[model samples]
Target: MTYQEKKSIVSLISAILIFGSFCLYMYPQYPEGGLGSAETFRYWGSFVLILTVVSIVAHIIISIIFNIVFRMTTKEKEPKFMDELDKLIDLKANRNSFFVFIIGFLLAMSSLIIYQPSQMMFIILIASGFISDVMGSVTKLYHYRRGV
Candidate 1:
């Protein structure tokens, strides 16, 4: 695979793993009374901070390992830099990703208006951002594979 393709795949996987892990961690802790409870809100607020730190650290470690493996497997003596086409593809992918983010943001805002739970809104915002990143990477990988 090309470097860009590999990078996108890594990013996609990272996003999925991070999000899934976060969900798994929080699922059992989810309040039976939902997010409206003050105790639940406090719990989620602290958990979100912890999750953010964990996700960031995990992604960094995964990225380092992926880069090392990629370098070891590839035959290229030097890493390839992004050309105009690559740049264009990235821009297009980001544009599409931005739309996804906007939609997610709208949904989060709507949820806040309906439920009036700041904690739920925060979680939704984080989830939406993660989904947006995953979509962006997927778009980039698709473009690379399709030679767009």
Candidate 2:
């Protein structure tokens, strides 16, 4: 297991855990108002905003911790620079992540066009964001393991 592979696995697991725990914590607080009520919009808006902040902070913390642990356990410092292969893999991962998110975005918009409840659009958008994150991690892990 190389460093990149281990880091990718950690990222993948952390993404899942963070998203799951956040969703569980927020589920009960969902507004009980009518689907398109102002309160409902406020709740969903806060949900996305807070989730974005929390996820960014959690990922940064996890990455730092992972680097520290890797150094302590393996006596190896983190890579000092990204070479061509690293850059390519990262680009591929980002491409796939954005692709998935764009598809989700289109679907969410279509839900609105079809006159679906606004809540449905929010749900779809949020789910796509989560899935795109997971997809990026998965892509990195796969590329690291299987060769770029």
Candidate 3:
């Protein structure tokens, strides 16, 4: 009902999404034939890799849109549904999250140049970005409420 409540709900949803993704990654394993371990490159390629790329990009875009809408709502004479604080926190987290991916990507490339790390670089980057975003978002919320 309150903006803080909305923010908390959104944060929880994001956390659930992240945890689910991790669970998907950590699903029970069995050895693969020649496709490589960690439960087949194809499975990784299909869901974890390809589907994730699309969804993550969509997530970013949706976040941006929601933030813009939240801000724009304030410009109207009518009271807005969302607190600007929520938008700020989300954007801060999103920005840091984007950089998280960038760093992960760069690290992946560097690692590949030497030798493949026997894992998909993209997955690591995505997971790191998600976790970092969550942490950043929570920190921002604390700072915001504390007026620090």
Which has the greatest lDDT? 2
**lDDT per residue, candidate 2, 2-112, as tens digits?**
899999999999999999999999999998889879999999999999999999999999999999999999999999999999999999999999999999999999999
What TM-score quantifies how close candidate 1 is to the native fold?
Answer: 0.81
Question: What would the per-residue lDDT of candidate 1 be over residues 1-148, giving only the tens digit for each residue?
Answer: 7777888898898889887888788788777775568878777777778777888899899888887887788845335577888999999899988998898889889987897668767777777778788889999999999977
Collision count for each candidate, in order = 0, 0, 0
- The alpha-carbon lDDT assigned to residue 78 of candidate 1 equals 33
Full ranking by lDDT: 2, 1, 3
Model 2 stretches astray by more than 4 angstroms:
none
lDDT tens per residue, model 3, 1-148: 4344445446646665755765566565423555355556655555556545655675676556656665677553323554676677657756766777677778767767877654656457656656665666565666456543
What is the C-alpha local distance difference test score of each model? 0.82, 0.96, 0.59
Residue 62 CA error for candidate 2 (Å)? 0.6
Candidate 2 lDDT for residue 86: 95
In candidate 3, stretches whose alpha carbon ends up further than 4 angstroms from where it belongs are: 9-26, 29-31, 34-39, 49-87, 118-123
Predicted structure with the largest TM-score when compared to the true one:
2
Comparing 2 and 3 by lDDT, which wins?
2
